[model samples]
Target: MAILSSNYSLESTYSLESTYSLDSIGLHTGLIKCPNCGQFHSNAMAPHGHAVWADMPKDTVDLTQDLIKMGVYSSEVVDLAKTLTENQLKVSLSQFFRDSLFERSASRNRLILEQPDLEQPDYELNSSNLVDRLCLEVVQEAGGIQAAFAAAFGDRQGELFENTIKTGKFNRRQFLARVLTVAALIMLTNCQKDNTADLTSDSPNDLAQKLEKNQLKIGFMPVTCATPIIMSQPLGFYEKYGLKVELVKMQNWAQVRDAAIAGELDAYHMIAAMPLAISLGLGSARFPIKLASIENINGNAMTAAIKHKNKVKSAANLKGFTIAIPFIYSMNNLLLRYYLAAGGVNPDRDVKLVVLTPADMVIKLANGEIDAMMCPGPFNQTAVAEKLGFIHILSSEIWPGHPCCCLATGQPWIEENPTTFRALNKAIIDGCNYASQSQHRPEIARAIAAPEYLNQPESLVKAVLTGSFEDGLGNTHNVRDRIDFDPYPWKSFSYWITTQFQRWNLMPSNVDHEAIADEVFLTGLARHLAKKLGQTPPTVILRKEQLKYDQFDPTDPESYLQGQIKKHGF
Candidate 1:
């Protein structure tokens, strides 16, 4: 019997006369050639009178024939066929599929595929509409058809599927049969557990007992400085440490602070000075935050509007102009202030410093709302990419080897989950080591540029990470140290940051900078982890930092601050 009529034009459908001889297969039998595999298989009825193929292995076909003798419909054999096909599907489909197959397989049979109730809503006879209905019926529980396509195939294949669907490359019969086959395959496989186990010397139960938490939500902003934290998810660094981490992309520094304070984020990517600020309750409630490791160093730049290319040649020229900073507690603000103070331009009185998200800073600069912006990459690179601004000065020029961002967590959470914390820090340190290599920067940029992470153009991100970029002034500069990763959390960095706070009058003068720096920056932990990871950390925690205007001795931060006050007259 003919299972269903083909909803395809005569020119599109394969000619049975030339492709196959009907006399050999017998037309009356419910058998048809699968256009996908070119193998004959038994056909069954699907929703909307579509044909579903029972394309099983020879042994499974014999088993189905045995069941057929017992009066079972061929549709029941479709389940077994699906199981075999799903087993043969490649694992590189998508991360979603791997997670779904391994995590939610036990409840696979319960997946309810909702049928479209609308009859002839967009022309039922249309081939495109027929395939759309088939997709809807199969993947309705998986966030509709497009999401299913993404989960079943990675980004590249998903795009191909979209293009093919749009161009109506597959007729209704071919598309419906494939959809039914895939749907059945996934449904059956969902009931089975993945046999491959990734374990260590300790048993599963022992490992689970040792770690207080294996799952965590790490918050991060969409900036290139958070490259290590963001790339760890896609690169399997977190998985290597036996962690199931969900990277929550936050909007702004304030949102990250609020989320971390509210206990919504177990850990987060924070500006180097934020831990000190949060611990002292400067801009947030008293939350004892610990700096695990410095994420990136010197990944910031002062970008000015294109029109101000010649007008704002130096920091002194920035006087009487408005500038944008990522946050009040960020290195962008501190470094910009330091650079301006050295140029005899008081950041507070000379240039207006407005707080804005990095993403919005580019827009505001393009709109001529802000004359300049001192923020982290690739926003500065983005402005250059769009020809809205030119790189005025890199933060490395202001203070070489300055700590830009850090990986931080609540001190209480760390104490509660010590083992998990160690594992998490190890993963972050590994990611940092990976990102430090100049050869890996291009790959790192591509991995983090996905919509879930930085969500910027790949070319723009590559330019920032690779340190080969146009400065929007017809100059291509290649500076490898523009952004570099080092996991060490130097106590000297904290001392310098606190000294800046004192210099800017952001913190009390008598606030025990040494004690706070020692308590907030986990230098000891970072040193230990770095050594354990086979990386040589600095033997001493204190070091002298040379800035554009003056030198900062960590051992004598008080003297440095007093001298800064004497020099800049702050």
Candidate 2:
């Protein structure tokens, strides 16, 4: 019996002059025939428990063939040997064979021991099927491999695994390697005990300990404006910062608002103005909600039915025609009203403004229930894709960098869970920075277009994010800045939204816009986090904004609103 060391190379062949008996080598007293030579050889066990021929062959191929004839054949073993030979890896064949056989035997024995009652008529008892069943059971127990990866590593790593699998980057061998690595990590995490002394300050365990709540439910509507919030889940931003977030899909803004107000959601995605309105108790019972960060900027667009392309080129032609706005508190409503008034069409009186959910907008326009819709993508883009509507104007065309949607959480929740809130804010801001890059748009579109998120066609979502699509007017446009993201919760945005709320008679005339803006915006926190993340946030809280027909001075919001009222003849 020979014992192979780690340095024993398979390239070197050795012939033993002395033969060992079966009892001395722990063999089964059998003579196995070499398939190639048609000669019977005494089989004996090596020191490492591998079957070895007493009279070994001089060639590696003949040794491999003999092993195969002795019932030690497995694709993995053969493939590994071939790979090692191709790569010139200095591994001993005997050691490799022993380790592979040991692992296989141990795995089979463990599974059989764990599931003793294996006499089912339909169940296959083969080792391959048993291993596959075990793997599936483990994955199911961990709520699928993606979720398990998220739990063991983070969301971003999980997303990488998902993409790798989806894009065929992982061949069978590479996939098995990754699965084994992730499984090992998951087992280690599960076996870890609570020991603060072993944890670093920035470790996930330490951060989780500091958080008031690690698990949270956040609400969002399936719109492109909620890109940062929606993409954060699938892209792994949330788990990157030590959070386990479950995104609850809401039907509309009203449902989102109600859920936030009812304390059913830990956080939510909302229009930029909703925190102010909710804080002021304008739309719902007064709830002190804080805008953690702006989710997206300039994603809204005005889309009109394709049939009205010639008849309704401008808002002036929209008089007496019914148009849809997602919600009264949304930027869609304010910007649409602003555009209509600029075109000498009073949105309130000259044209009927109806509140319709964005999800129903395209269908409503197609059915002739509404003439136009002012909403977010991919609904606007979906209209164009289905030939129901052509984009009349993008909000960016009206205001180049207008704030649209925001990430919000109740003030009380923030107060109780400040650490968790900061983590959540950082995750969302990271998502914003990621989505702000045009290169990531298509990947984001594919990620969020699944049934759990947007539930829209991938092409429609891709067109909206990539900003390259047909306009339903015999034109292909590539407007890269069509929808953009900025996480900074600018106070000027709040002031502008409040002014619009008052301009449309949604809020009282005497309300303190500046004070409400200061209370709800959380600009200081946004600035701090933005700077922490290596972003250049504005030095001041307010900045002047240029609109299509007018400009806004945040320092003199009242005067700006008065000028707007006078210009529109309000």
Candidate 3:
């Protein structure tokens, strides 16, 4: 049995007819299943009583205890994101700042896992069929409640809605209801009129036509996961492709996201989850985002401060510890929780996670402010360089070839500037190919180690790039793929991410995960660039084998989420 569990309760109820304004945050209403009755309920169910969530109102969602525990290290950046999300501020504010804040606060009391919580709810539901129907009806119905009802059930809204008897799909149906209610409460949060002006593109015969915008601005953080993007600027890959690129090194993930959202950046290095979060309107709904290509694979590790090397040998010692991850909705959090759950440690009950940017992770670890951190790049290597931390496990050992970073851009930018997009993709593709070669890694290291780039010791940067580095236990290891660059955006990777969001309740409800993955992940761009570069792309796009978890099957996600999650699954 897993150590962590949730004392399951139902969701909060807000009046559907609440005074409407054009701008509102997400609707507070949601639905949960009754463990005893085996039926769905919209209000707080019995057995789990009403309680304050993270000291916030019950209407706001509550995170798992594992996330709550990490609240001790929460930063002000989170408040800014919430403010930006709940209400409009600057047009690009949400995308420009560092995402170092936890959306949740921690309870002062000891976290006890209860018998029931949010995990698998019998079966998966197709949200698109529902939301699309609702979104369309709302558009066609002319106005008011009739539009919402037509959108919800199309024809069966009042028939099934007013009845007391509930079916198995009732929980799924109710979620759409909440979405509709929220949609009604808030008329799209976008205050700015979208700019869809089309830019010039290539003539089929002249596929290599001049770009619409050649001067490109990109954003990055000083982490190892972004080696290709960072190295591209100095290695002349961008120049080789006839593009002048300026890499804006940002302080944190929030800033990276905000800048991208605000159009301050043409493209950026981002966590695999960040793009997904933005597309779902988790952080900001203003801009539709698209991922150009995956930037890295297996380029991270769980590093603990050197002082705790002896005291903290395994997951058991991590209880009551404050650990840090680069941001919310990231692979680091997924990997850490998997490790904890597999080791019989309840992440929510035993420890907490706080959001810290990759660079700050080294400083905080050294100061003993954070016991450990799962972060990307040179920061993990920097920790060993400074003798501040030791590597407990290379993230690859947990999930090999697991994606880390991506080359992502706002969707508006992609549509308006297709020619520029291809040029940028070609440059990025060329850089990825160059970085993949082991022989050139040392030179690549020297290029990115400039004061303007990573600004780290060349040797430290070289070690990670060349797959040879100190493991922080005094022994040197040559770890190939320690930090690698790959541009393929496998559907499996996207599907896998969707499962995690559902497992943790980061998403409102089940949507067409594969469809969304295909829409946002520009696999077509990778293929086009690969052909242009005379490189053969992978014949198979979906990953054939699972890495760390024997249970994770993207096709059958609930089997893993419900059966594998120690406390919440049951």
Best by lDDT: 1
Candidate 3 regions with alpha-carbon error over 4 angstroms: 1-209, 566-570
- lDDT of every model, 2 decimals: 0.69, 0.68, 0.61
- Estimate, for each residue in 398-468, the C-alpha lDDT of model 3 and write its tens digit: 88888899899887686566666766777777788888889999998898888998888899888888889
What's model 1's TM-score?
A: 0.64
Query: What would the per-residue lDDT of candidate 2 be over residues 1-570, giving only the tens digit for each residue?
Result: 211123222221110100111112212333433211223444332234335556755343344345544544444333433332222111111222333446565443222222222111111121213333333332344466555334324444334334333333212233333222222222222222222122123666556775678899999989988899889888988777767889999988899888888889899999988888888998789988999899888888889998889997777888888999998888888898888889998887898888999878888999999999999999988898788999888899999989989999997677566667878888898889999999999999999999999999999998888888788888899988888888887677887888888899999999676678757877766765675677776645666688998878665678889998897797
- The order by descending TM-score is 2, 1, 3
lDDT of 1: 0.69
* Decreasing lDDT order of the candidates: 1, 2, 3
Which ranges of candidate 2 are over 4 A from the true structure? Answer: 1-203
Backbone clashes in model 1: 0
Worst 10 residues of 3 by lDDT: 191-200
| Model 3 accuracy (lDDT, Cα) | 0.61
Model 1 error, position 221 (Å):
0.2
Candidate 3 local Cα displacement, residue 414, angstroms? 0.8
